[model samples]
Target: MNNSPIHILLAEDEPSLAMIVKESLETRGLKISLFADGKSALQGFTKGNYDLVVLDVMMPEMNGFEVAQEIRAQDEEIPIMFLTAKSQTDDVLKGFHVGGNDYIKKPFSMEELIVRIHNLLNRKKLQQSSEQFRIGEFIFNFPQQRLIYKNNEPVKLTHREAHLLYHLWNNKNKVLDRSYILQKLWGSDDFFSGRSMDVFITKLRKKLNQDPTIEILNVRGYGYKLIIPST
Candidate 1:
């Protein structure tokens, strides 16, 4: 995983609603930059590094669709989710037409919003992940399923091992939920899958133990977190 918080750009005109959304997302461990208008949001997008963009459909100065167009021009892969009250089919189609990745109707639950945001982020990550990753002294090659260190023979990894390591690396510095990993790799989070994950986790730990600075920690009852300083 990257070594920074998930930063979000939010464009909402209503002060109360903006604050509520900001606080709610913050409590869930996200960093939000709130703007009161679409133009200001576009400006923020230009100046700030952000993981995702959430834009309210109706705003002064500009609208969500306009901002999305600008953002899409600048960064084609960044997730753009529209917060709209419009129920008309044309409006929904228009949002997608302007490069909106997803849209939620107004009066959405924090839970639903969180789920959508996670889904978008996950999809973007999978699509754009690099073929290789650096983990402390080791370089991980996802496509080749190999782990190489200094000039020595690379450590060959099984398909499952490579897949797991790639995801762990994708979410390095953040706690990766066990259920999420299980579902991605095993297709279900059943008891058997959980046990299988434990075995793989043990195998990975041993393989990576040569680097003292790198750790795949079991976050107690939650999940695993790969702790490695940026190289």
Candidate 2:
């Protein structure tokens, strides 16, 4: 429970329904960005940071399933909910197959919709908390904000350091785009923040260098990659 408003990307072609959904969520202190079709919704998704997406299945230009697939290609972690008139078993399966976290049938009650939204977000929060990442010989306990190695004294990390490490750890062995990292963690990719990120990376390197098998490699003008030995 963070009291901050949850930003949602809502794509529903029906104007009246969209207005009602928007008003309902806004009254509950949630921020909603409404788009009339799937393509516009995809654009909003890319340009704006969102906690979750609510997609109407039948839409012009593209559909909810297509939009969810496109969103999954970018960030698989973001939660997606599908709203559809079809409640067929096949349709529900298809939604889950396309990376939907939750499915809500059309003509649903406002209370039910809000409850499902909260539940999906809460589930994601729980997953993030329980996630334990292995970094070479170290265990990154994200919830505890501690880096534990060989069951020895754990290295306590500052909030920023822990957040940064979580991102790097999640993208281990992959060249994480610098702008993506900055935008996700620091909310900006400006010159000052970029320099600041470098400083944190250097500090992280020093902290993690005790194990020769662990390495954080810089990908030239791209980003940083966390490398951990396979064995």
The local distance difference test score of each candidate is 0.83, 0.82
Candidate 1, residues 1-231: lDDT per residue as tens digits?
Answer: 566889999999999989999999999899999999999999999999999999999999999999999998887667788898986766765676576766778898888788888977875666456578789899988766689886778997654577788889889999999999877665447665566678778889998888899999999888999999875
Q: lDDT tens string, model 2, 1-231?
A: 567789999999999999999999999999999999999999999999999999999999999999999998887677788888986756765676676766667689999888878876765575476767888899888766688888689986644466678778878889989999776544347664566678678878988877889999999999999998787
Candidate 2 shows a clash count of 0
What value does the lDDT take at residue 182 in candidate 1?
A: 78
**Candidate 1 at 29: error in angstroms?**
0.8
Clashes of 1: 3
Assess every candidate by TM-score: 0.57, 0.57
Model 2 residue 192 distance off true place after TM-score fit, in angstroms:
51
Q: Model 2 off-target regions past 4 Å?
A: 1-3, 133-231
